[model samples]
Target chain A: MKPRVALKYLGLTPFAIYVVIFLAIPTILAVGTGLFTADGSFTTENLLGLFAPTVLGTFLSSFWVSAVTAIVGAIIGALVCYAMLGTRTEGALRSIVDSASSVLAQFGGVMLAFAFIAAIGNQGLITVWLQDAFGVNIFENGVWLYQVPGLLPVYLYFQVPLMVITFMPALQGLKPQWAEANATLGGTQLSYWVRIAIPVLAPSFLGSLLLLFANAFSSYATAAALISQGAQIVPLQIRSALVSETVLGRENMAGALALGMVVVMVVVMWGYSALQTRTSRWQR
Target chain B: MTKQTVAQRIGAEPGRITRWVILVVVGLVFAIPIVSMIEFSLSSNNGHGYTLDHWTGLLSPESARTYRTLFQGIGNSFLLAAVTVAIVLVVLLPTMILVHIQFPRLRRVLEFICIIPITVPAIVLVVGLAPVYGIVVRVFGGSIWTLAFAYGITVLPYAYRAIQANLDAVPVITLSEAARSLGASWPVILWRVLLPNLRRGVLAAAFISVAVVLGEFTIASLLNRVNLQTALLQAGQSDPWVAVIFALLALAFAFVLLLIIGRLGSVSRNRSAQ
Candidate 1:
């Protein structure tokens, strides 16, 4: 390599420094701090405290809600992509819809929270219309909607689009001729879909769903905006541990919790990766 | 044969009905959020009266200060995103080339690092970085800079994966060999031959970064920075209309991003074909 080449390599310094200080160092600190006690002794208090009823409830609720969101989003997204396949309509409408889905996929967190609230809050249009026109009360006497249920619509804001994006390539990979041939063989619609369509779309379906699960599980803003106080998921709890300095004196506790969450995510994502590898065969 | 023939007869007829049903149902389901938002924004006194006070109020001089604040937040967000894209691209491009050149085994490791952030959740990241951020702020004497730091880490997965895919697509060794044979320096091969070829990935990554920055509410709000998402949240607390308008604007931002991505993808495809 010449001197100029070496000089260009030096350009890599800014990025290298930024990543170290911001990402690596801080993450290490969070784990280190959360795992150690005030007396400089290693303790599992924070990680154990993570199992407290309040924290556990939030985790369980988030798990179920996120699971539903991922599955539903993937299914719907796959169906949407399937419907769009081979359609002759090509213009602004198609592009607009595609764009809309893409935007919604990335538009989660706090913005999604606000969007859902505005759309479904107490005095929200949907809320009011449902009450006056149909005499239905979504949250009449229960804290259900605002808790885990309310998080669903917000989750969908991103989940559906994520599914659409992830599943599109998979859909395209499935040869239409296979379906045509099956149809010509006098196969029933149900059998054709169950035997052929499902098998072909299975890998994409599984991969997309897993990806969606990871997306929703790691979500913090949507839950925070929806049920700020009561339901404390891992992320919110982690944020709280950092902020409430008076109570959370042991930084190690925070670190332990952070490390635990990272571990769980790694496991989940490992499964996702395995699914992706298995589904690679479906990709044309 | 009869069973197969019977199944085929049904399959031969397109499930147009099911297709239409799925289209209408899913389309309506997806449209609900946007429709509800528009209704809320257009409603007066929180939908009690059908008036455009919320929309009209936005234009009034009284709302000017708030608009200024909102615009400032947006500006800060865009600046953060711009810086983030530049930082991420610089880091991702060279690292990608080096990994392909020297450490093929490290590819998965690097990818794991990138994807780890995705699974960590924004809240965890903010929590983990808060102490680090505080120290940096105290030492460096700046708070807004924290947003860039946080955004950079959170979006690393997106940037890395995109660039990695693109790197895999192009003939990396061929390009490097071509450069080497021509007396081109490694830097020239990396920058001129490699970086230019990685344009599509860069664009996609940039868009993801933009989306991440613009829509980043947790980290910004947690740190009490007045980014667009935080401002929107605060506005909603005071008056629901503020949240509604913010949501509309957010949708607009998302729409623009989508259009840009679509255009970029098409252009890249066209170029690749050529």
Candidate 2:
């Protein structure tokens, strides 16, 4: 019986070994890369690079971008969910928004950045059209579409939809019985939401907010495609460190930068999971 | 009871006008860029006036040279998507099924392992992968297809969730027990009994793998690979319109795929509950 049970776990070996080699080891090496020199001698010098102004600036911008998008997206997406709450389960609008949000949420990257470029880049469609019709230079402020602020609109494209996708379940999980109960106590429509739904949804909302923050923070291809000139975010910082020739013997900067990113992601995801547990409590 | 009692089932249908107002406003925000992409792609040049030349240029002789790399990237991405999907179906699928029926205790650990990819961003993963690829190159050749190994990890959190949701919905244990009572072999049971039942989740996992692989850029680009995104970026440098056109096309393809996925999600949940 013991041998048979051991044999049952044979199926896990392929996946276990795969992640260990590709994921687990690489994660360890990624964090550890900053602590060693080129000749493989252990040192802590390269990690100080994480504190350098440029990296800090990138992290600052990353936080600002993520926080803004997460907040804005959470608001818009929560409103979208509130809008969707009225529609029947099998309604066309509900499913369209459901599927559309799913698609938009996953579909951001180079393609999305290009779509925005075609819309608002220096010679973009809207840029050209607006110039021709109204004689207004939308890019008079230095082609913001290609800069850090530019990521907001593009990031929101995915962020809002992702908010809708993740937060909708929490919205839908609102039991009908609660509303009826609130009404039996002579509570108004506004009162029910103020008292019951808001409190119950606070954790889920915060949880989704954290998720969106991590998402926007870690997103690379969209930012990489847009901000072609400099490292304006954490992911882009890692990119430049990976490719630039002028790291000045600091090969571990990219490692340190990646380590920084991993730390943020770990903290944010940990909070998200904790909130998720709290959220799921009411869900069941 | 005020007028609220009549609509209490869904809790006050929120004023239909209000609902439409919010949805339409948000919908248009999402739609504007897509419309611009189409309009931009249709334009002949950066100047005024429009022509089909840009669209027709795909068949032109010069475009063949211009887009040679783009074609190679698309091909490589498709191959990567196929291999990645194969990995999910073959390795992840069986392990999940086995864990569900045989070793239920490992489910949480397996879930954690699968989800670990989400916490480590692709950029950070690439930082770690640079060295692993060294070993990967030594063991497997430096072919672009091997990049699927990393993609397999990236797509894990997605594929696992899709399959596991279905696994939870299905009565895998009951079916396997009955099959065993009928004297069926484990291989036969998995092949004949389980795969058919998992069609929705399995197909969803495969579609998700394809969608993710097509959009992947960070790993392939950092690792010096040629895939759809890297190819698109390069092509955009020379001919931006064609690049936008292809981006629009990829976007449309993904939209349709996810629409189906969305349907699959509800269909499975409803069927299993009943």
Candidate 3:
């Protein structure tokens, strides 16, 4: 590199400093603060709190929601992509879905929760309509829609769109030549998919699955908006540990919860990246 | 004998009906909430009959007092959005261009740093930020706008991808080198030449950053600050109608913003191809 080029690297310093101070330090403290006492001495007491039944239950609930949403979102979104495969890649329909997916993926948080509330909350539009037309009640079993189970449809709302956005490129990368070659060999449609397509797509599909899991696992706003009471999941647990609904500041318990969440995200992202590399080889 | 017939169907393309059916069903899952929002917002306060007071209430003078918290939160979110976008355009954008132009080897490191924020969830990040913010309050005086510092970091992955994609597509180094050979100084080359070409990516990144900032709640709420989402969450608890109304507007704003980003991408693609 020339001196001029070396000088150019100085342009990165501000961004580097900004990221280190805001992102890196907070992340380090998130995990490190969990392993020590408030007096700054080392202790595993906070980590041990993670194994307590209530904390364990919160982790299980978060995992369950993330896993379920990831699986269902992957399947449905892949189907959407599959349906879209025949459409012209640059056609209006493709652009519409692409744009819609990006928007809907961003359209989580309070807006999404409010949308769902208006749709199916107690005395919601669908709630009243369903009762009037079909005598059916979704909340007949005691408002599961307001609890962890309720997070299912809401999570799927964003997850499926995100899946479509992430998975569609891989779907598009499936060349026509492979199908043509499979056809020339007299492979049936099912056989072609099972043999040629499924194997090739497996890495991308699984990669996308992990991405969805991490997304859902890390999601906060929708869960925060929907469930106003109780720490039913890890993020909310972190919230409750950090602050009650009105009050601010709490003990080191939130740090342990965050450390666990970080561990999960890191593992998932690692798998996603490794699988992504496999998918990329095919992209070329 | 039947080999050719089997081969003919190997593409596994679903029937047109299947495609339309899948699209419609999923589209309805998305549309229903939006429609319900509109309907619910137009409904009487009792949730019985239809009315437009909630929508029009936004501009009512009386609402300034009644909905002060929600409006304040909205204003703070807008301010945060602008500041966060500034942080991206000012800090991240130049670093990316520098990496692309001068130190190609650092591209990977730049990407790694930007993407790390995605892996660390905001909720988790807040736990770490709680103590850090105590120090932040000492320096920044506990203003809601300080939340944008965290918002800037949280949006790194999204911002990086948008700008990096454009940086990759455009020949940043070639363009800059050409400008340099023509006696243009580095800053002049950057400001005059590189910025114009990178407009689409910069716009998309800015818009996406705004979207993310406006939706930010966990950090602001936990940090004892109020932004749009926190205020909406509070309003939803007391006055559900007003909350839903504001939520609908926020959704519309984000929807339009993202659609423009998508258009910006393809429009540039077409122009370049032509």
Candidate 4:
């Protein structure tokens, strides 16, 4: 190669090596292990195991949890974003909310779960207060705090803020001119949103929703902390397979489950990128 | 603007109240749990009244073993964050600037590679890193600090985006050309000229890396390494209130870090505006 060309390639060497060691090779092993047997010969047994009733059930439940959180989070978050948009962009409230959203979005995992337990767990302050003050038992129905039913709200703590962060830029990208133009043409507020605003924001909104789904789907720490036992979601299932001493030879099963998660997230990310590009075109 | 007044005449002002109301409601929804955590952490174990025992216990010598792991995890997480941020800046800033300057066509490829981790969940990344961890342990020995290498990869997507935004904002090519013509070497230009201009982005990236490393649980826990979050988890299993205290502390730490970054960002913006 020419000296200049060689220099350019040399610039890439450190990053390339880092990615290869930490990302590329490990990913290869993850997928590769799933295709081989205990003897190391290639087989599809682990992949097939992903479809067994228990494994499939975990995937389905995980999907349900992700789907519910995504939809609920998107609606609430979009409303929050819309409210913030009505304020001056550089105002204190807007900046505070924006920064808070950024922090809260990353503020998941064990601490988040602990926060929920402290709030609404069986002995949580709110639960105790409600019982003592109003004679209402928060757990009279059952102890849902540690189950999938309870995870929905806990997940939303981060999810709503995350949605706000991702969706705000798109919301800001919307030009006031579009709405003004609609008004000038004798369109009503309802008509403007129905015909123009919703259609314009659809791709970005859908993209953000998919991102939320994938976010909740792959999340493990909060779920792991809350559930404590059994594989309620795909991540927990992977955790069990990896950590459970009794599950002696299930490392490949963990790979298979990991593969399943990758496939779902890959699809979600593809759609997110496609929508992002579409939104950017108009904004630019 | 004219149309905005016309629309307001038709009563868009109602939305102003609705907006405030919605903001208040959303704010409460977000605040309740955090408030509860604080309240629970301070309350007596019997739930009859309040005390600071949990907070004090974290510091008391009686809980030395618990606090030892917690402190070690916190220290390790900070070390990892510093190292990871350094690695990100050292490796990414130059390569990104070089790519933007010399190989514009390679920008997409670089971005794609950085974003690969987004789709690869941490759980999955742990799976992939399992065998790699074996090699890493063998060569480097198993110190929780080596987790920084994995963290550097995980933080790539965010760091790259932050640095890319900074690179795009500054006239890197023009600045470098001007500096070169002034007899500055490449390292001098990068360190003295380019980096100063990219300070906001670098800080943002570092803040994100720190937040991520501090909050990271799965990789550390699964790897049997005692980082802050994992230590909190183990502590929570024994005494839940103590865990909540640590959780609140960590959250406050991240909140303060973000607030500082936010302040710096706006200060820089104001300076540039002037």
Candidate 5:
């Protein structure tokens, strides 16, 4: 009532202007460019082309790898978080674990590939051990664990720690007294966790897994970096479409492929959100 | 009853055993790669014999040059993050203030806009930015500055989340109004009242910016910047030992940042409790 100037300043002046310019514009361009041909023609060709068996195989492989990683990560994270609970440790150990977790959590993509290579490549430290001690030949025999199965372990390098960091807080949030209460009622560790801990942790656990899934799905550089150039996930495919030298190759199709990836992401995220909303009710 | 007795026995023993087995397996999975890194770092390039060569190499004059190059990368990262944080603070603080002070109706919309970055993959952002950067650099005579602009957008998620969380924590309307009613100017209110209350958020934001800027790979890799990460990649390609050393160094850097953030968080919580 006192000053119309202040209201005008707050409503549409600075904040809205910045949002429309930087955030809105860039994001709009990303989506819109992905939906159209380079020459500006509208086409569903890119999206439709994803249905090719080779492309579909790439998507499925990545999906399967991510799902396996999520499950393995969740189990590992839950176990570590549970063990660390109610345990006394020196400050150094805690610091070390925390540091390890931090590095592992952020350890991803291309850089991660390099780390793994140094550890297990043909000239790698472990490669020598595997060859000499165990009479195993990774190079000649072509180990599945270092190829198709290899990607999962690499993904888990980040995923496991991610699972730990994400779940640690929620795991800690559960009342210690609740466990004690169950024990007093003559319930065993099994029954106590089954009845109490799992229920408490379900939301955080699911949410963390959803995040990991999305993260693994969108990841391009990790698979491309660790595995050979032949690896073909959706993000890698999209990347190739954008950057490939052959100009005649489908640039518009690439945009459409990128758009298709986003749409799949949206669907998965929406499904996860709806599931989260349903399961979160149990926490209360 | 009899049913209850059977259920209890089956449930208890298996669960405890399962938990222990699961913990050991997972722990090994996480621990093995790290062990491999250390093992590789400790051994010499020529043979499997133990040597402190890698650690010693990191301390030599040539090593100092590498560190200098790394530091330069760190410096560029700091500049990018600092500038981004400053710009975000300048933009976000008032927007936060306006939301609390004048236009509560638009707060949700504002918040949604801020969070849009989290979902946008860095690679996608880089590719989308290619045409823009080409135009900006070739046409407008800006090279790395355009990269910084892109980096600012990339880091928006981290800083925005921290600032937003801080904004949610403090008494925004009361502080702003109190400052305003006392004839304090907008900038003064923001600097004195708002910024002080936002110390924790600012610290968190700074930590996040440092972590993100230091470790960011996609954009820097795509653009082929001589940033530390890309340099490490180049070094790795040229020399495996150098790659191993850089990996160890990276681990050290990550650990230190996490420790600082952890301590800051604990300190802030203690202060708030007091």
Candidate 6:
């Protein structure tokens, strides 16, 4: 009613229109299409197809990759953060580490996959060097570099850095006074970490891990670049269903897979937010 | 204090040694793959010895044809990045300032909207964008640059948080009132005073937008647009060495860009403090 209030509302108009057009409508289409038939009548076949062995296998493998990367990344990244704790915050070493972590954490997709391939693929530098110098063969068993097992290490390249960035704040929130108090109370280092530090940091750690899992689960380009054939992950499956010329018409199937991914991500992110709030309480 | 001496005795010797070891080990693990990329890129395909062949081969006529797509992809991505950054700044900066100044209660809703993209995975976003893109193409004549509209959304969460941090650090109301009292119009207050103060945040947001655009693959590839990442992946199929070389160069470029932005951010912070 008032011009001042109307102007305030007007400030939000452009972004609201953009969001509704690009984000909100499309997302609704993705979820809504999954519940319908190709003829435009309502049907549950697309959703039901989600439980087929092939589709379910892709989901399981994706979950396995995400979970492994999340757990390992959390432990290693937290350790690195602890090591960082011993350094001066304003020191050159700390700044370099922080900056590198920030850049590398966001570094994924095609280039990242190529980097790993260059380092460890069949004709990679490391593989060739090992054969030349030591008569050892990395492919002695099989060429696993492009397989799901090999993806573990490649995923960690980004995941560990992400863990460092996310987990470092919680680590810094820990006050030295608590450690001093524990020592004064006749507690050993192990007991201090076990009884005090771990409990305080648990929510933050779990939150970071969940974030990492969601990140890895949703990633597509690296896997697509490395594994040329087969839809090994959910993302690849969606890609095949959408673009593979031979498949003809699986558009709704892609929608179904996307809906499944959305559900998982929504749950993971909600939990992450809850844990974030819990962690912030103690932090403040 | 007794606690001080005890902490010194307990943590001073072994703790320092253990900490350094962990730092060094972690650093090496992170650095090795990058080091290996450089080494592999330089080595001869026959494994005889190191050579500049891969670098020189990029100039060959055959390589030129192959590189056309890669170069085009790079150009398109750069253009998209620029447009996305421009759109984000134009749309978000004014809205953020207005909300902070006149309607603080709407801050939560703005934050919630921006953060929703993070929860919606890129693949799902692509799925949603597919049918919409069909209509967009039919209407807009299917230009590659239309991808910027989707990309602007993807960068929303990062750009919003960066600008919000800058906003949170300054007293927007106080600054505006002082300028108004000095007879400065809203445009002058925003452009001269607020914009300069928010330069660091703007730079950070722009850097992130560029990096994300360069690295993004899922949406572009799914939508049938040949962007940098997709082109590189396709190039890897025919000539792996050249592709790897480009990948290394792009990664280094992004790293340098981010490092420069970080330096600029801290320099501006120090200047303000002084």
In candidate 4, stretches whose alpha carbon ends up further than 4 angstroms from where it belongs are A245-251, B1-14, B59-66, B267-274
Candidate 3 stretches greater than 4 Å from native: A1-6, A244-250, B1-9, B271-274
| Superposed Cα deviation of residue B197, candidate 3 (Å) | 1.3
Ten residues in sequence with the least summed lDDT for candidate 4 chain B: B5-14
| Number of the top-ranking candidate, with TM-score as the measure | 2
- Where is model 3 chain B poorest over a 10-residue stretch in terms of lDDT? B1-10
Candidate models: Cα lDDT each: 0.73, 0.88, 0.87, 0.85, 0.67, 0.85
Clashing pairs in 3: none
Candidate 1 error regions (>4 Å): A1-16, A88-97, A180-187, A245-253, B1-14, B46-53, B59-62, B66-69, B101-105, B172-196, B270-274
The candidate that achieves the highest DockQ relative to the unseen native structure:
2
Please provide, for model 3 over B1-274, each residue's C-alpha lDDT reduced to its tens digit, 9 standing for 90 to 100: 3233222356556566778999999998789989998998899976577888888887888989988999999999999999999999999988888778667788898889999988998998988898788898899897878888999998999999999878887888889889989999878998999999999999999998998898888898878798999999999888888998888888888889999999988987787778
Considering the two chains of model 6, state its CAPRI-style docking category. Answer: medium
Give the CA lDDT, 0 to 100, for residue A178 in model 5: 73
lDDT by residue (tens digit), candidate 2, A1-284: 69877787676799889989899999988888888876789887778878888778889999999999999999999999998875678888888888888889987778989889888888777898899999999888788888899999999999999999899889888887788778788888888888889999999999999999999999999998887867888898788888872553587778888888999999999999999999998887
**Weakest lDDT window of 10 consecutive positions for candidate 3 chain A:** A244-253
Each candidate's TM vs. the true structure?
0.87, 0.96, 0.95, 0.95, 0.84, 0.94
User: Which lDDT value does model 1 have at B1?
Assistant: 25
Interface RMSD of 5: 4.6
Better of 2 and 3 by DockQ: 2
The candidate maximizing lDDT is 2
DockQ score of candidate 1? 0.46
- In the range B86-195, model 4's lDDT, one tens digit per residue, is 88888877788889888889999999998998999789899878779999999999987789999988899988887887788788899999999999998999899998
For all candidates, the clash counts are 18, 0, 0, 0, 0, 0
Q: Give the alpha carbon lDDT tens digit for every residue of A1-284 in model 6.
A: 99977876887899888888889988888777878766788877888888988889999999999999999999999998988775666679877988899889988988888888878888776888899999999889999878888889999999999999899889888777777888788888887788988999999999999999999999988898888878888988888887762352444888788899999999999999999999997777
Tens digit of lDDT per residue, candidate 4, span A122-219?
88778887998999997887898888888899999889999998898887776777777887888887877788878888999999999999999999
Model 1 iRMS (Å) reads: 3.4
Using Cα atoms, each model's DockQ against the true complex is 0.46, 0.71, 0.68, 0.68, 0.32, 0.62
CA lDDT, candidate 5, residue A67: 86
